[model samples]
Target: MIWSLIILCGVITFLIRFVPLSGIISSDLPLSVKQSFKYIPLAVLTPIIVSDLSIMENKNFFIIDNFKLYAALIATLAALIWNNVLATISIGMASFLIMSNF
Candidate 1:
């Protein structure tokens, strides 16, 4: 049963990926479509980061922490200024680790 489920998932993944690359759909998209797709990463990551940064307790829910949120902010700045993936991730992770230790 597990093997069958794995095979099914693999097939589904293959179909999802393959259908996009195939000629069944038009490759040329409008400027609006491209612009919206470009913001997909930010749209997806913002909520997750905000949730992690926020403090949630029985009495208080609005408190912001020191480590993860600041690290993420610095990382975001690094990415914007440097436009480099490796540097952004390194700065983000390093800051997170360092701040977490304190």
Candidate 2:
């Protein structure tokens, strides 16, 4: 049973990593379809950012009293001003930690 589970996991992992890079499935895609891949990062990040800014209380989404939302906005402004990834991440994390604590 354990070996079968390991083999199943390995096959799933291989398929996940291989299907995108194999080029076998992308050969016949339209030009627009190929170009749309450029938005993949943005598509992935939007939900993450939104979820981080919202607070779940009593099974409801609440924006009020969410310090994370304000901290993220401040960090975004800092990133725009600094234009540095490290600085942006540092500012974001620091703001998040400070806000979470108090």
Candidate 3:
């Protein structure tokens, strides 16, 4: 089952790239299409990140000492300051681990 799911995902991913880049859809995608695709990462990531902030450990974000929320804030700051993906992720995960152990 897992193998089939993986294969299906790979095939779908390949087609998403191939159909556009291969010119089957268009040789030059419109400016609008390109701009929309840029937001795809944010659209995909926001909910996944929000779940940790809101519902992780069965607690609300406003509750005191929510480590995931703190970690996310740290990660957001790191991203804004350093603009480095590796640094943001490392700091976020590290802070979460440390705070959770406290």
Candidate 4:
């Protein structure tokens, strides 16, 4: 049952990711639809950011002492400054490790 559930979840995830691309590539999307597609990344990211910022185990509005949050912020800044994924991840991980020890 566990294996079946995992397989089912994997398939569903794969289909969701592929379906949009398949539709776009297989058919000529209308101009408005194509324009709207450009905002997909922002649409996906907004919910993730909202959930990360607002959701907490103890009903806290902010995670002030959260090392991961600090690390992520540092990473974002590094990415903005350098425009490099490796640098951002490295900085974020370094921040996380340093902050976690305290």
Candidate 5:
């Protein structure tokens, strides 16, 4: 299972690299197409963050005691304020640790 996952990821990585170099997607992309490309990060990040915030270990969901949700909010704020990758990560980790213990 792990090997297949690794191989699959490798193949995906290779294709992501290869497609541009191979000229499969040309630089002649339309204005709309180029603009929509801006959403790729949000498209990728939204599902991961949303799923994490919306799920619980017991297969139930509640927002009242959601320390992770709070931590994520804090982290997002830190990211916006500091705009530094290391600071955002540190703040996120520290906030999660502090919130979860309380």
Candidate 6:
């Protein structure tokens, strides 16, 4: 019963999200709407980044011992420099492994 409820909720959520997008993309959107949509990616990403950065268990903001943070930062720099996901992930994993050991 719980599983069925969960599945039903997921389907409803997906339909609610997709139906509008399907309509918008299928038909020609207005110029104003298209222009407004250009900021959507940044708007979505900014809050996520801020939320991740702000949420922490300890008082120290740096969290120097957290290997995941180091890995993610290194990965972000690598991605910026190389423009490659594989390289970024490899660098991140290597950093994580090195940090975890020490």
Computed on alpha carbons, the lDDT of every model, listed in order, comes to 0.85, 0.84, 0.86, 0.82, 0.87, 0.81
Model 1 ranges off by over 4 Å:
1-13, 26-35, 54-59, 62-64
TM-score to native of every candidate shown: 0.58, 0.60, 0.77, 0.61, 0.77, 0.55
lDDT of model number 6: 0.81
Task: Please give the lDDT score at residue 45 for candidate 4.
Answer: 96
Candidate 2: stretches off by over 4 Å: 1-29, 56-59, 100-102
lDDT, candidate 4, at 52? 66
Worst 10 residues of 1 by lDDT: 55-64
Which residue ranges in model 6 land beyond 4 Å of their true spot? 1-28, 45-55, 58-62
- Stretches of model 5 off by over 4 angstroms after superposition: 55-61
Per-residue lDDT of candidate 3, residues 1-102 (tens digit): 999999999999999878866766756768998899889999999998887587455453364777888899999999999999999999999999999998
What residue runs in model 3 are displaced by over 4 Å at the alpha carbon? 28-30, 55-62
> Candidate 3 overall Cα lDDT vs. reference?
0.86
Residue pair clashes in candidate 1: none
Pairs that collide, model 2: none
lDDT of 1 at 16: 66
Error of 3 at 99 (Å): 2.5
Worst 10 residues of 3 by lDDT: 54-63
Give the 10-residue window scoring lowest on summed lDDT in candidate 2. Answer: 50-59
Better of 1 and 3 by TM-score: 3
Worst 10 residues of 4 by lDDT: 53-62
Stretches of candidate 4 above 4 Å error? 1-28, 49-55
> Worst ten-residue run, lDDT, model 5?
53-62
